[model samples]
Every structure is written in C-alpha cells, then in structure tokens.
Target: GAGVSQSPSNKVTEKGKDVELRCDPISGHTALYWYRQSLGQGLEFLIYFQGNSAPDKSGLPSDRFSAERTGGSVSTLTIQRTQQEDSAVYLCASRTSGSGGYTFGSGTRLTVV
Candidate 1:
C-alpha cells in the first residue's frame, strides 16, 4: 500500500482472549506510532518506533500491551487478556521524517464482550 494500512478492520472477541493488530507503514518512513481511542474519546498514544533508537513504550497503559516495528516498516500491536475496557479503535500512523507529514490508517475496531 502507498499509505499506512491496517489489517482486521474490525474484531470481536470474548473477554480474556487476546488479539493482534497489524500495520504496514509507508516505505522509507522512519517513524511509526500506535494509539487507541475509545468511544467519543481522544487518541491515547501507546508506543512509538523511530529508526534504530529504542521504542518509547512509556505510553502503554499496562504490561499486557505491547508493540513492535520490524525492518522499519511493518508494525504489530498485541493485547493480552483482553477486557471490556480494552475495547477501542487502534490506530497506526507513520512519518518519513521529523518535519514530514504523517499518514494514518483507518484503524482496527476491537470489541470485547
């Protein structure tokens, strides 16, 4: 894809189950980010990957949430032991440089019951 792309646009899962969301960033982009947004809420940063430097996972709400960007392109977000509160739209964004514009994916809506 020319722009950021996310897989499994919608997911419904039982409580305690786990889910994995994928993102493919634009080619040559050196920055990638993951965020979550609940119903009528603002986006909350989850993690960030920039070049070879360490990923800033400080925004992750819990240890159960994790993400990784591989080969500086594709990224994945994993949520363990999903709970009702974990239900939300996961968004992925990427940028080619610090001052460049960003491209965001449509997001993956997760519903936990």
Candidate 2:
C-alpha cells in the first residue's frame, strides 16, 4: 500500500456485540502498533509487533481485546462483548526497520451502543 490503511472508518455496535477492525501497513515496514483514543483523550498504546520478537500486548484493556498480524503486513483488531465505554478510535501505525517514527492510519471510529 502507498500508505497505512484502516478499514471501516466508523463502526456502530450494540453493547455485548463483537467488532473487527483491519489495517494494511506500508510495504516492507517491519514494525506495527495499535492504539486507542477516546473522544477528547490521548492515544494509549495497546499492542506492538516487530518481526519475530514477542508482541507487546501489555496495553490491551482486557482479555476480550486481541489482535494478529499476518505476513508482517496486514493486521486485525478484534473486540468482543463490546461496551458503551469502549467507543473510541482504534489507530494502527507502522514504521520501517530502525525507523524513528510511525505512519498512522486514518483509524476506525468504533461506537459501542
């Protein structure tokens, strides 16, 4: 992809439902990350992956949140049993090997009703 891409710029779901978001990173980049930001809030790191290294999933709010990257390119973030408080923007970022900054996607605006 020419730039990082995220699917479904907006999502509205009822409480307790599940939603899945997608991200396609820039070609040849080796580092990926996911973060969350509530309306009027700051970005919060959720997870990160760098090649074969152990994924840093420390910031996931709960076990119901999970993600996976395939072939070091595309990634998916899945949320289970959504709650109203979960409404927020889910952002994805990627950077080339040894890069100092990340390129972010437009993000998926998830709204849990």
Candidate 3:
C-alpha cells in the first residue's frame, strides 16, 4: 500500500466482547505505532514497534489491550473484554525513522456498549 491502511473503520461491540483492529503499513517503513483518542481527548500513545526490537507497551491501559507487528509491516491491536471506557478512535501510523514524519491510517472507531 502507498500509505497505511486500517480495516473495518467502525466497530460496535457488547461491553464484554473482544475486537481486533488491523493495520497495514507502507512498505519499507521500520516504525509502527498505535494510539487512542476518546471523544474529545488528545491522542494517547499505545504501543510502538521499531525494527526488530521489542515493542514499547508502556502505554497500554491494562492487560486487556495488546498490539503486535508482524514481519515489521503489518500490525494488530486487540481489545479483550471491552468496556465502555474503551470506546475511541484507534489510530495506526508508520514511519521510516525516528526523525521522519508519520503516515497515519484513517483509524478504527470502536464503540463499546
């Protein structure tokens, strides 16, 4: 893909249901990131994957949230036992290097009832 792509732009789930959001980043990009934005809140960093190193998972709110990047090109974010507080727009971005600008996907809007 020429840019980042995110699947199933919108999702509505029961309070306890789980959901998986996918992201396909630009080819050759070495950095991938996940972020969350509530109704009117600023983007909150979730996880970051750079090259072959371990991902930074410090931003995950709880054990229910997890993300993984495969082969350094694609990624997935999973929400387990979702809660209403989890409702937000989940964004994915990819960059070629630390100093480079990020190319962001449209994002997946998760709605937990």
Candidate 4:
C-alpha cells in the first residue's frame, strides 16, 4: 500500500468484549505508532515500534491493552475487557526512520456499548 491501512473502520462491541485492530504500514517504513483519540481530546500515544528494537509500551493505558508488530510491517492492537471508556478512534501512523513526517491511517472507530 502507498499509505497506512487499517482494518475494521468502525467497530461496535459490547462492554467486556474484546476487540482487535490491525494496521499495515507502508512498504518500507521503519517506525510505526498507535494512538487513541477520545471525543474532544487530543491524541494519546499508545505504543511505538521501531525496526527490530523492543517496542516502547510505556504509553499503553492499562494491562488490558497490548500491541505487537509482526515482521516489522503489520501491527495489531488488542483491547481486552472493553469498557465504555475505551470507545475512541484508534489511529496508526508510520514514518521512515529519522523522518519528521508521518502517514496515518483513517483509524478504527471503536464504540463500546
């Protein structure tokens, strides 16, 4: 793909259910990031993967949230025991190493009801 791609553009899940969001970055991007945007809130960094280095999980909100990048191209973000507060637009972005610009996906809108 020429740009970042995300799956399940919109997801409606019952409270306590689990959900997974997928992201496929550009062919050669080396840096991938996950962010969350709540209504009326700014983007919150969730996780970051750079090349083969250990992922930076410091931004994950809780133990229920986890993510991994496979083969350094595709990534998945899983949310367990979903809650209403978890409803948000999950965004994925990618950029080449040392690049200041990023290409972002349309995002997966998760609504927990």
- Model 4, which residues run further than 4 Å from truth? none
**Candidate 3, backbone clash total:** 0
Candidate 2 segments whose C-alpha is farther than 4 A from its true place? none
Q: Write the per-residue lDDT of candidate 3 for residues 19-93, one digit (tens) a residue.
A: 999999999999999999999899999999999999999999999999988888889999999999999999999
lDDT of 4 by residue, 3-112 (tens): 89999999999999999999999999999999999998999999999999999999999999999999999999999999999999999999999959989999999999
lDDT over C-alpha atoms for residue 111 of model 3: 94
| TM-score of decoy 4 | 0.98
Predicted structure with the largest lDDT when compared to the true one: 4
lDDT score for candidate 2 against the true structure: 0.94
lDDT of 3 at 98: 60
Instruction: Select the stronger candidate by TM-score from 3 and 4.
Output: 4
Which is the better candidate, 2 or 4, if ranked by lDDT? 4
Query: What is every candidate's alpha-carbon RMSD to the true fold?
Result: 0.8, 0.8, 0.7, 0.6
Q: At residue 79, what lDDT does model 1 achieve?
A: 96
What overall lDDT, based on C-alpha atoms, would model 4 receive against the true structure?
0.97
TM-score list, all predictions: 0.96, 0.97, 0.97, 0.98
Highest TM-score: give the candidate number: 4
Q: Which sequence of candidate numbers ranks them by lDDT, best first?
A: 4, 3, 2, 1
